[model samples]
Target: MVVACCFGMIEVVCVEAKDIQSAGLGPVTLAIDSGSCTGLTGPSGSGKTRLLRCLADLDCHEGDVSLNGASRESFTPPEWRTQVGLLPAESFWWSERVLDHFPYKQKPELDSLDLSPVVFEQPLRQLSSGQRQRLALLRLLANQPKVLLLDEPTANLDQDNIMRVEALIAAYRNQHRCCVIWVTHDRAQLERVADRSLTMANGRLDGDSS
Candidate 1:
């Protein structure tokens, strides 16, 4: 719970979780600094996705999570989600039309993900899996979230698209000072994007690498 106090404002840790306990994971503690990316990697079924769900408050868990020094309790579930956006392995779309899922008159930086604006006019069913994945990220970013919980966001993309997605997220982190917890199995991707990386195994975190 260490935090810097300056002029009655706390601008130190961007995200903090204490003793987080959830399905496939338990009693985990970690902190993410503002405007930095932290990579979490491990074998399949190592509880990475559950950890992200717990942090996003989408899964039942025993823990304390806070953003910008404000406890998650301070906001309702929906409100908290707006600040802590989660991009799941597979994104869900409620509307058949691509544009319906996004904010009206709001143009996402589509080019950053190698998407043309015309794609927005197409039907959701017409989009490829990779295209949908990219659009889902853009939709999440449209909220300008302070924290991003990404679960293998580039898994469906090719190498070029992977680079594009990484660059886009890096740019967002730089421009908005967004805190990120990127869960991936790609060691190469981890090295490229993470300021520091941690390994999770058997419901615990260890093996710190920078």
Candidate 2:
């Protein structure tokens, strides 16, 4: 039941997959906490996205998903979303200027994370792949959610940007004391950030903490 050892301020968290029957995920269970730093490695079509969507209440399912002690169903969609935020594989921007998307006035955190200052002036469509990834993560962090669900966040970035994004995520989690459910196929990325590792095979999550 103890997935990892907790150190400093991180708390222990557990997720039990009772029955993923109708949703096609079957009965699966997994638990993760702080200081594990493991990753989830799986091939395509493994239902990683589906599992994350279910937890975010983006899809309906038969099993129960609780955070702390409250069930996901207990909160309204907006309320639930504010508590549990999901950052998709592809980032979105509505305005031509990159800075138009963010609401915060001062983002010293963005600079500390190694994001380029030019990113604020350039159009979203004109940015390179690494820029987009950092922008997406910045937007998500600005929301200050209690839980974060990330899907391949750094897949398109270079080594420098990848490390920056990893450090940013770790800083956000530590500062906010948030629970992160990251879905990634990159073993190195997982080792760099995750506190625990899990794999999805045939619609079930098995605890593979190594």
Show where candidate 2 strays beyond 4 Å.
Answer: 1-23, 34-38, 104-108
Model 2 worst lDDT window (10 residues): 29-38
What lDDT is reached at residue 127 by model 1? Answer: 90
Q: Quote the positional error of residue 4 for candidate 2 in Å.
A: 9.5
- Tens digit of lDDT per residue, candidate 1, span 4-123? 533344548999999999877978999998888999999888888999999999999998999988999999999899899999999899988777777784777788889988886888
lDDT per residue, candidate 2, 1-210, as tens digits? 443334534355633344654366756555444323336557777778777777777877777776666666678888777777788888887778766666654443567557768777677788886777778788777777777788888889878777777777787777776777788888777777776688888777655776
TM-score of 1: 0.93
Could you give the C-alpha RMSD of every candidate to the true structure, in order shown?
A: 2.9, 2.9
